[model samples]
Target: MRARYGCVCFAVPKKLIQHLADRSGDEGHKQMLQAQITQSAAMRGTRASKTVAGVATNAGAKPLQRSVFDAAGQTFLPGKLLRDEDDPAGRDKDANEAYDNLGIALQFFSSVMGRNSVDNKGMRVDASVHYGFHFANAMWTGEQMVVGDGDGRAVKNLSGSLGILAHEFCHGVSQHLVPGGLGVVQVAGMPPALKGEAGALNESFSDVFASMIKQWHAGQDVKAADWLLGEDIFTPREGRAVRSLKEPGNTKLTWREDDQIRDYRQYKATDDAHRGSGIPNYAFYTAAAELEGKSWETLGQVWLKGFDQLRARSTFLDAAHATLNVAATLHGKGSGTHNAVKAGWKKVNVLA
Candidate 1:
């Protein structure tokens, strides 16, 4: 069957790889790392070719239908089923981490957002851990979640991070909810102008929800939250997370550019969707900070509702207008929430 969508993977950034290569004492090891990074860059173009086979779900009102698979460091997916929803935890740490994190993601959507599941129809959540040989990335494969055991030196086992799992899960949520399935427009052979904005929106939405989920799980308020995604995946010595919403340009690694763009004038049209996502991510962060409370409540709700109003080819301005309307509808036009939304967009230069 044709793939449901082409999803983005949370891979180690090129700059990080370059930094690691430069720091390596062994020339042989440096070459290997450089080769790996090059291979990953090439793989992005063929990501859509990877198909995820469908599995039937049991019918019921079960709290969560979760299945975690062990790929056992091989390339094949959904490799031996290690745990199911009813089964007790096994000896495998990766399997257990995957199972627990999937539960957390499901709980966040159901309890906080009042959504049934990723599809809002109680569809089963399936995840595969230990996928590929030191694969160094994680993704939602249109059908299920796949996390790799990262190369120990540069990256860690991705299944261990709750934020990463939540981020990938949110990709599935966006695919099922957003019109034309966000970034999937590019995979469908649409023009670049139509695809870039959708793809950037897709990436930004995932980052926003991922940050929100992490903060909610930690019982952190907006101010207390670190506002970093994939913090757990990177080594502490690296001193940088995958991305930061609070401070875009501030990175632990010196080679990386500031990923956060607070103004439209700073925006660059790049083929890399993740780089282009800084605009919307900063806007969401700005709105949440201005609201100054539990982000998942007001700002999160407004953005969630706003997603439904987004067209297939919606631009950043379209998102700003939709979110403003949502905030005003949720709270009166003159309310704090409405004003915060307006100010957030204006701060990002999306609104005049």
Candidate 2:
């Protein structure tokens, strides 16, 4: 059997697709856009089934290896190696953005968390930009990151957004660090009963780290940070973000109807990973707010340590326990850090 890993996508949601479809002036154009979205969705599903090939694993002592490829609006993997680590920035804005953001993400893992690279062993980071014509999505394909330039009407080029790039890259990190690779469905060894919860954790970890990296890059403290994911990519009128950690269910800023849930009691077992991730995302935000410092300082370390300790089939309750234990270990048994972790989980009903 082939070793399988999760594919993380930053795709425009179905709701937004519907909204865009409604707003499209030409009926034929609307149908075409909808069809394109459908095709992208189908492509994602297919990619999920494919096994990881050619991508190197964490190995040896090497500096950061960054590569940016230009797909030039074609649906192919690693189209042309446009830039490597030795090359200076060129004219393509999308490629430049992808390369620079990859560096930022790589730096965060290396400097803040003391991780060598995405896999903690210097795995090369590679990205492909301008994938497909108005592809309307971006994804980490278990091997490399593929970014799309969205349909000009509804969405913008995804590679231009740092948050989205970081989010996808973090998925690569989670796949390497976590057991069973954080897939949406239960991988071979994961407990069947915990599949949904595992999926939620997969997304929650990505969003949490993504926010942390963005904050770190912006030099924002926990209190000052917006705690939003994909804010740059989404138009303000369309929505503020893909998800908001600070205010989980409040959409006043974003106008997104399906707001995130703050408490575990609000969790829907049937909800997809992105929707279900709100619970843990809010829990992280609450913990960061309670700690009241740079998010990457204490809360980030705790979460990173917790990710290392997470079980293959870990659920929200498991995460709460792991993070709380990590906090105590790192910040003293009954210190404020430990208390903050406990309180944050309690707010989300993960703990009493």
Candidate 3:
């Protein structure tokens, strides 16, 4: 009856959440955060099953048609349909924001990328807001989106952050764009995971595209864009943003606890997907800066299409080569754009 992407991906990393849990002084709040992580991990199996059956699509639906549901502080997904595409804004703030955010994502993909929807088949966007009491994360469940209210202690107002919303939405886009969920792989007994370097590339794609979407929507060029991911997600006392593509692991640009590494040589297999994503994220930022134009105009579609060449276990070097080939194909053998793309990967030590 519905379509599901091939994997489960979240805008917020589990490692970051675990960090918050560890530092939290309130035992009840810490336990609640931990419980949420457990619940989230369990969702992997349920959503992965939906994808295994095949990606059922809405071939007849329009690009902008969507439904935003109100979860009413419960963990169940898409609790109750709050607003349809044609419906007026509702009384609930989070629900309306979720509805609008999804609309923005749909418009960007359709109008700029010339894509119908996440599945490129006009699939209706489904989203839910107010999921879980004081939940501090947002995630794409392969089937739809789930947004949290935030704990107010560290993260607050998740539904209101456009960057964060776009990041999660792009998780859906990456899942559909690259079959087998980019870097995600479904093991025999476990849910599909963003494992190894491929998983980090998967995360990097989301950050790159999410940054593009934000810049495009704001009428910003590469120079004008803030280049901060989830800048509004955390409390000021905790950090500035969740991550920074321009300067990954620069805690001054993000939070004090950020551990993202931009150099491929610095990447460890044990690093969280978000941490490892800094390599590609910085690469894209560098190239876009060198190209000196809007990221969407210069590299967005190429990056999106380039990911289609990815396999289940594709690594950083694999991504670097694939994206460079895509740029060369679209621009020219040694065109300025192609060279810029190469420079990006090379800057991060992903290319020779």
Scored by CA lDDT, what does every candidate get? 0.76, 0.77, 0.82
Stretches of model 2 off by over 4 angstroms after superposition: 1-3, 6-8, 23-25, 48-61, 186-195
lDDT of 1 by residue, 146-232 (tens): 888876766788888887888889988887887567755553343222146667788888889988998989999999999888888
Q: What CA RMSD would you report for each candidate?
A: 3.2, 3.5, 3.1
Candidate 3 has what TM-score?
0.93
Q: What order do you get sorting by lDDT, best first? A: 3, 2, 1
Candidate 1 residue 204 C-alpha distance from true site, Å: 0.8
* Residue-level lDDT tens digits of model 3 in 1-352: 3434333676777877888888889999899889878877776767532221122245436668777877899876667778877889989998888888788888999999998877777877777898888888888888788899998798887998888998888888777776567667677778767878988998988899888989998999999999998998888776788889999999888876789999989988977788899999999999999999899996887787778888868898888888889998899978988998899999999887
Query: Which ten-residue region of model 2 has the weakest summed lDDT?
Result: 186-195
For this target, which candidate reaches the highest lDDT against the unseen true structure?
3
Between candidates 1 and 3, the one scoring higher on TM-score is: 3
The 10-residue segment of model 1 with minimum total lDDT is: 186-195
Q: Is candidate 2 or candidate 3 better by lDDT?
A: 3
Cα deviation in Å at residue 236, candidate 2?
4.0
- lDDT per residue, candidate 2, 126-204, as tens digits? 7899988777778787678889887775578888787888888888888778766664463355322114677788888
- In model 2, residue pairs whose N, Cα or C atoms come closer than 3 Å (at least 3 residues apart or on different chains), thus clashing, are none
Question: After aligning candidate 3 to the native by TM-score, how far in Å is the CA of 350 from where it should be?
Answer: 1.1
Alpha-carbon TM-score of each model against the true structure: 0.89, 0.90, 0.93
